[model samples]
Target chain A: MYVGFPHMGNAHIGIRGLFKALGILTIDLPPVNRLTVELGAKYSPECSCLPFKTVLGNYIQALEKGADCLIMLGGCGPCRFGYFGNLQEKILRDLGYDFKMIILEPLDWRQTLRQLQETFSPVSWKQLIYASRLAWGKTVAADTIESFSHFYRARQSRPGIITGIYQRGLEKIDKAYDLASLRTIVKEVEGEMKAAVLPFEPEIKIALIGDIYTLIEPYVNYQTDLKLGEKGVQVERSIYSSRWLKENFIPWEKKKKRRKMLRDAKGYLKNMVGGHGLDTIANAVRYSREGFDGIIQILPMTCMPEIVAESILPRVAEDYQIPIMSLAVDEHSSDTGLQTRLEAFIDLIAQRKKDKKDYFLSKVHEAS
Target chain B: MKTKIGIPRALAYYAYYPMWKTFFEELGCEIVLSPETNKEILDLGVKEAVNDACIPIKLFHGHVSSLQGKVDYIFLPRLISMNTERTVTFCPKFLGLPDMIAALDTDLPPLLDMRFDFKKGKKQGFKGFYEIGKQLKHSYWAIKKAFQNALHAQYEYEKLLAQRVTVQEALAYLYEGKELSKPVDYSLKFAVLGYPYAVHDRFLSVDIINQLRKMGVTPLTADMVSSKRLAAQAQKLPKDLFWTFSNQVIRAALYYLDEEKVDGIIHVTAFGCGPDAMVDKLIELEAKARGHVPFISISVDEHTGEAGVQTRLEAFVDMIKLRREQ
Candidate 1:
C-alpha cells in the first residue's frame, strides 16, 4: 500500500517509489476531488472548507483499501496545523475508526540531520545519502509534474481538461520501474504539458489564506485548485511550506522580527488589536489593495492562532468591501455547505462588483 | 435624578438577571435589556470582533453592540470571583472583556467592572455593588437599603420558582400588580449549562427554545438553579473550577440532578471555549455516573452550521428514548 503525500510539496513521488523499493505495501489513490470534499463536509462540521473534508475523505477512502496506519504531516505556525492531528484523531474515533497516526513534526537542520543518522541504523552515511538522493529525485519529479499540471489547469480554456491530463500523466509516472524510466517519462510529459498552453484570463481572482498544509496539499485540500480552475477563477493560495520556511524564509523573518519585535507587545498587540497577527491582516489588506476578488480565510478547527485571524476578518471585509468568507476547516466540516457558502460568497462578490460599476456609472451620469 | 441602566441579554442574564434587575429597580434605577440578537447583531459582532475570537466573544460583541447608547452605561460586570479559591478564572476573553469592550467601535459607557470577592462570604461582593450604587448617588443608608431589598426581591423570586412555580407565579409575589401564575404547557428539561456568555447569547444559539419545542421538548434552563449551591457542587470536577461561571454550571448540573432532575442536559459552549473544554468533560463524566441522564455538549463558534447540530440533537433524543424504553 503505497501512500501518497497528504498534501502540498509532499506529492510523495519518490517517497512512494522508495517505499516500493523497501518492500513496503503502499497504495496511492487518485488525489482528492470535489466529491471527496462533499462527502467529508457532509459528515463534518460547517466551520471547515473543502480541504479538511477532502483529506479526511481521502483517509476514509484509504482505509477501505485495507491501509492500517495513517500518517499526517505536522508543523507549528499561525495556522494551527499543529493541533489538527489531535482533533483528526478524535474525529476518526468519533466515527469509530482507529489506526496508527504518525505525525512527522517539522524539524530544524540539526534535528533533520540527526533523524537521518537514526534512520540509517548502524549510522552509515553512504546508505543515508543514497536514500536521500532517491527521495530528492522523486520530489523534483513530483514537484515538476504537479506544478506543470496545476499551471496547465490554471491556463486551460476548458474547465477540466488538465485534471484528466494529469490523471493520465500521474499513472504514467507511477508505472515507471526505474529512475531512468521515471526521468524519461517526466521529460516526455513535461514537454507535452508545456506545449498545451492555456488562455490568459485575469478577471476574477480568489485568495486562499490559511495554514500552508491545507492550501497546497492536493490530498488534504481535495485539489481545490482544480475546482477553482474549472470555475475559471484565478487562485492565489498562501505558499508557506514548512521546509521552505525553515530553510529559506525563517531566518530572514526572525532577523526582521527581532529588530522590530523584541517583546510580544508589537506582535501580540497587533493581533490583540486586529485579532490575528498584524502581518496576516496586512497580507489580507495587501490582497484587498491588489484588488483581488475576495479573501478566503481557512484553517483547522479548534485552532487558536487562526481565531485571531477569524476575529478581524469582518474588518477586512468591511474596509475593503471585498466580501470575505472566512472558513474554519475542521475534520467535521461539510463539503456541500462549504461549496454552497463559497458559491454564495462568489455571488455576493459579483453583486459587489456590479454595485461598484453602477456607483461609478451613476457618478459619471451625475457629472454629465 | 436616577438615570436608567441597561443590561444586555447576555452573560449571567438567565442566571443572575433577576437579582441584578431587582437590585437596580430597588435602587430606583430603571433597567433596560439589550435586544435579543439577530443576524444584524451577529454581523455587527463579527465585524467588531477579531477574526480568531471564540463564538461567545463574537456573541458578546453582538450583545454589546445592541446595547450601545441604549442606557446610561451597559453593565460589563467583571465578576472576577465569588469564592475564596477563585476556583474558576474564565477564559482570557471574559477576564479581559472590559478591555475587549474598550477595543470596540461602539461608544460604550464606561464599564461597571463589578468585581466580587466571596472569600468572606457575600460582604465584598455586596460592598463592590454598593460602590457602584454610591456612584449612582444613592445615600449611604439608601444604598444599604437598596442592596438589602434587592437581595430580598431576588430571594423571593427564586424561592417561588423552586416551589415548582411558573414565572408568573414567581413574579406574583415579587411584582405587586403582576398577573397570576399561568402554567406554561412547557416542561422539557434541557440544561443549557455552560459558562455565562455562551448560554445567554441568543445569536450563538438562536431558536434554541423554539428548536427544542419544535422537537416537542420544552427547554429547562440550567441558569434557573441556585448559583451558590451549584458553585459548591462545581468543585466536584477533576480539574478544579478555575472560572466563576464554570463552577456555577457544574453546580447547576449537580442541582439539576439532585433537585429538579431533568430528562436530559445540553451543555453548550463556544467553539474553542477553554473552560467548557474541561468543564463539559467533567459534567459529562459526573452526569453519566448519576444514571441514564442523556447529556450532549454543543460547541458553537462563528462558522456554526445548523445541520449537524440538528442531527446531533435528534441523535441525542433518540439515545434518550432508547434509554427510557430500557
Candidate 2:
C-alpha cells in the first residue's frame, strides 16, 4: 500500500523515513502553495479553519498522485483540529475518491498500533521500534537544522545564503539511510552554519508564538520568519515539531517544561484554552523575561485558542512592557500588508531600544 | 440577607440555569442573573471578548459585565462534560470560561468556578457540587439535600424540553413555576439545529423560532429530542463526535434526516464556531445525498442583520413549500 500524509512543515521528512524503514512505499504531497489553498477551499466548508483547507488540499493532491492510504493526526476537541480527519474523509468520499485514512489519535496507542500492524503485516515488532527511532531522529535533526538556519539567516552577511544551506541540509537528511549518517549530516550542517562569517550583530530578537500550523508552515504564514530575518531581526520560535512530539507523546517529559510555561502563564491566562493558547501567553511572558525585544503572535483567522490568547496578550504586553503584534491570517491575508506591519514592528523595537539607552544615559548623567 | 451570586445568561446557562439557581438558592444565596441579551450587553461583550471569539462567548462576556458590580461572586462553572461517554466534551471556551473572565481586566467579583464532569459517574459531579456548598459554609446534609433538589429541578426542566417546548417557554415556566403546554404543529415542520446559545438567544439568532412561526413553519430544535434518541442516532456514524453540543446537534439533524419527517432543515451556527463547521458540513451532505432535504445554514455574529435573516428564512420556507407542492 502506498502511504501519504499531510504536509506539516518538515514532518514529511520524518514520516517518509519511518515508512521507508518499514519497507512501505510512500508518496509525499507537493509543497503547499496558492493552488493547494484554492483546491482545499473549493472542497472545504466556507468557514473551516485555514489549516484544514490546506491539509485537505494536500491529501487531494497526494491521492491524485496515486496514494491509496493517508495518515493524519487526530485530536479530541475543544479545538477544530480533532474533527478534520472525519470531515475530510466525508468530503473525499462525497467527491468519489477511493482511499483509506488512518487517524493517529492521542491516548489511543492501541488503535494506532493495531492500524500499524494491519498496514505492515508480517513485520516484526523490532522493525517497528527501529522505524519509530529513525523517524524520531529525523524529526529532531530537521528541527535542529531549521533552528540553526534561523540563527544563520539573521546573522549572514549575504541574503539567501542561509536558506540555500537549509535546503541542501534537508536534501542530505532525506538521502541519509541510517541514524549514524543522519547524525553526521546534521552535525556537519550545524558546523557549516556556525562557521559562516557574520558582518554585524542582529539588531532585535522577537519570539514567534501562536498556532503551530501557521507558525511552522512558511507558505501559510507568508514566510514571516524569512521576512523578519531579512529585516535584520532574529526570530526565536517557541514551538517546534520535535518539542511538540516530546511534550505530547512522551509522558514523563511533558510535565517539566510545559508545566513551567503554564505556571508562568497563570497570572495572565490561568487555564488551558487549548491549541497552544496557553503556550502563546506563556512564551510571551518567558520571552519578555528573557529580554527579547518584541513578540509576534501569528494564528489563523477565527482560531479559538489563539483568539483567547490574543485577548489576554495585550495585558501581558502591558505588564511586561514588551511590544507585541498579533497577526490573524487566512486565505485573504495579504503578503504586502504582513510585510508592512512586520517592518513597522521591527522599527518600533529599534526605536524603543534607543529610547531606553538614551533614558539610561540621561539618568547616569544626572547622578554624576 | 444572603450573598448575591451572578450568573451569565449565555452558553450553558440556557441548559443548566435551573440546576445552578436551585443549588445556590438552597444554600441561601440570592441569584442575580444578567438580563436577556441586549445591544448594550452585546456591545460590552464584543468590546471585552477576544476579537475572534464566537458571538455566544462574546455575549457571555456581556452578561458577565452586566453583573460585574452588582454581585459578590460570579458562578461560572467549568463544564467539561454532561455525558459520561469518554468522547464527549464541551467547547474549549466553556472549559476555559472562568479563566477567560478572570483575565478580562475588569473589577469583577470573585468567581465560584466549579467543575462539572460526569466521566467518573455522578460521584465526581457530587464532589464538585459539595465543594461549592462547602465554600458557601453549608453543612454536608444541607448540600446533599440541595444537590438532590437541583437535580430534580434540572430533570423537570429537561422534561419540558422533551415534551417539545422551546427553551424560552420552558425557562419562562421554570421561573413562574407553571406548566407550559406544547404548541400545536403548523403545516410545514422544519428542524432547526444549533447550539443552545445560538438557538435560544433572541439577539444572536434574531428570534428565528418566532420568525419561522410567523412564516407558517413549525421549528423543532435539538433540545426537543431526548438524549437517548440522540445517542442512538449518533451511533449510526462510524465514530461518535467528541464534542458534547456538536454531537447533540449532529444527532438531532441525523434524526430529522433519517425519519424524513421534517420538510427542511435550518442549521444556525455562530460565526467561526469550530465544531459547527464540521457538523454543518456533515448535515448538509447527508440532507442532500440521502433525502434530498432542503438545507439552509445561517451564521450568526455581532454583524448579522435582522432583515437578512428574515428574508432568508422567508425564502427558505417558500422554497420548501413550493417543493412540497411539487
Candidate 3:
C-alpha cells in the first residue's frame, strides 16, 4: 500500500523516513504550490480555512500518483481542524476518489495503530520501535537545521547562503538510514551554520505566532520568517513541528510549561480557546516580557481560534508596550504583499528603537 | 437595589437563556436582556468587533455594546462544552467571547465572565455556578436553590422545544407562563438548519422562518429536534463534528432527509463561519446523495441585504414547491 500525507515544511522528510523504516511504499506528494492551492480552492468549500484547501489539493495530487491510503492528524476541539480529515474524506469520496483515510487522533493511538496495521503490512514490535526512533530523529534533525538557518539567515553576509545550506542539510537528513547518521548530519549542519554566520547582531527581534499550519508551512505563510530574516530581523517562532508533537504526545514537562503559558495569558485570555489561540496570547506576553521588539501573527483567513486571538491581541500589545500585527492569509494572498508588510514592520521597529535611544540621550544631556 | 446583570440576546441566548435568567433572578439579581437584533445593534457590532469575526460574533459584540451603561455587569459566559461524554464544544469565538468583548476598547460596566463547562463532573459543573454566585455574594443555600430552579427552568424549556415549539415561542412561554399556541398547518416543511443565533435573529436572517410561513411552508429548525434524536441521527456520520451547534444542524438536517419528513432543507450560514464551512458542505452532499429532498444554503453576512435574502428564499421556495407538485 502506498501512503501519503500533507506537506508542512520538512515534516514530509520524517514521515518518509518512518514509512521507509516500516517497509511501506510512500507516495511523493507534490509540494504545496500554485496548482495545489488552485485545485484545493476549486474543490473545497469557498469559506473553509486555507489549510483545508491546500491539504485537499495535496491529497488529490497523491491520489493521482497512485496512493491508496492517506494519513491525517486529528483533534477534538472548538477549532475546525479536528473535523478536517473526516470532511476531506467525504469530499474526496464525493469527487470519485477511492482511498483509505487514516486519522491519527491524539490519545487514541491504539485505534490509529490498529487501522495502520490493518491497511499496511504488519510490523513487529522491534520494527515499530526502530521506525518511531528514526522518524523522531529525522524530524528533530530537520527542525533543528531549520531553526539554525533562521538564526544564521539574519547574520549571514551573503543572501540565500544559509537557506542553501539548510536545504542541502535536510536532504542529507532525509537520506540518513539510522539515528546515528541523522545525528551526524544535524551536527554537521549546525557546525556549517555557525561557520557561515557573520559577526553581526540583528537590529530587531520579532516573535512569529499564530495558526500552527500557517506558522510552520512557509508556502502558506508566504515565507514570512525568511522574509523578516532577509531584512536583518531575528524571527523566533512560537511553535515548531517537533515541539508541537512532543508537547501533544509526550507527557514530560508538558503540564508545567502549559501552566506557565496560561499564567502569562492571564488577563488577556483565560481559556484555551482551542487551537493555538491561547498559545499565541501566552507567547506574545512572553516575548514582550523577554524584550522582543515586535510580534507578528500569521493565520489563515476565517480561522476561528486566530480570530479570537486577533481580537484580544491589541490589548496585549498595549499592555506590554509592544507593536503587534496580525496577517491573515488565504488562497488570494500575494507574496509581494507579504514582503511589503514585513519590510514596513521591520522599518517601524527600527525607527522606534532609534527614537527611544534619542529620547534617552536627550534625557541624560538634560540631567548633566 | 438589586444588581442588574445584562445578557446579550445572541449565541447561547437562544439555547440557555431561560436557565441563566432563572438563576440570576433567583439570586435576586435583576435580569437585563439586550434588545433583539436591530439596525443600530448590527451597526454597533460591525463597528466594534474585529474585522475577521463572523457575523454572529459581530452581532454578539453589538448586543454587548448595547447592554453597556444600562446594567451593572454584562454576563458573558465562556461556554466551552455542553456534552460530558462527547468531546464537543462551542465555537472558538464562544470560548473567548468575554475576551473579545473586553478588548473592544470601550468603557463599560464590569463583565461577569463565567466559565460554563459540563465536561467536568456534574458536581464540578455546578461548582462553577456556585463560584459565580459567590462573586455575587449570594448565600450558599440561595445559590443551591437558584441552581435547582435554573435547571428546572432549562428542563421545561427543552420539553417545550421537544413539543416542536419555536425558541421564540418557548422563551415566551417560559418567561411569561404563556400557553402553547395552536400549530399552523402547512403544505411543505423544510428543515432550516444553522446555529440558533444566526437562524433566530430576525434581523440577521431577514426573518426567513416567517417568510417561509407566508409561502405556506413550515421551517423545522435544530431546536425543534429532541437531543436524543439529534444524537442518534448524528451517529449516521462516520465521525462526530466538534461543535455542539454544528452537530445539531447536521444531525437535524440528516434526520429530516432520512425520515422523509421534510420537503426540502434550507441551511442558513453566516458568512466566513469556520464550522459551517464544513457543516454546510456535509449537509449539501447528504441531500444530493439522497437525491430526493431539495437543499439550498443561504449565506448571511453583516452586509446581507434584505432584498438578496428575500430573492433567494423566494426562488428556493418556488423551486421546491415545483418539485413537490411534480
Best by lDDT: 3
lDDT of 1 by residue, B76-123 (tens): 765555457633334335444554565455678766655544556777
**Candidates 1 and 3, the one with greater lDDT:** 3
Error of 1 at B252 (Å): 12
- Cα lDDT for residue A269, candidate 3: 88
Once superposed on the true structure, which residue ranges of model 2 sit more than 4 Å away at CA? Answer: A255-258, B177-182
The TM-score ranking, best first, is 3, 2, 1
Per-model B-chain TM-score:
0.78, 0.97, 0.96
Prediction 3 global C-alpha lDDT: 0.89
lDDT of 3 by residue, A34-93 (tens): 999999999999999999999999999999999999999998877888888989999999
Chain A TM per prediction: 0.64, 0.96, 0.98
- Segments of candidate 1 deviating more than 4 angstroms: A1-25, A33-55, A73-84, A87-98, A104-206, A211-214, A217-234, A240-269, A272-280, A289-311, A317-368, B1-58, B70-193, B199-266, B269-294, B297-326
| Displacement of the residue B72 alpha carbon in candidate 3, Å | 0.9
State each model's CA lDDT, in order: 0.61, 0.87, 0.89
Q: Arrange candidates, best lDDT first.
A: 3, 2, 1
Best by DockQ: 3
- For candidate 1, the lDDT comes to 0.61
Off by over 4 Å in 3: B176-180
Question: How big is the positional error of residue B90 in model 3, measured in Å on the Cα after superposition?
Answer: 1.1
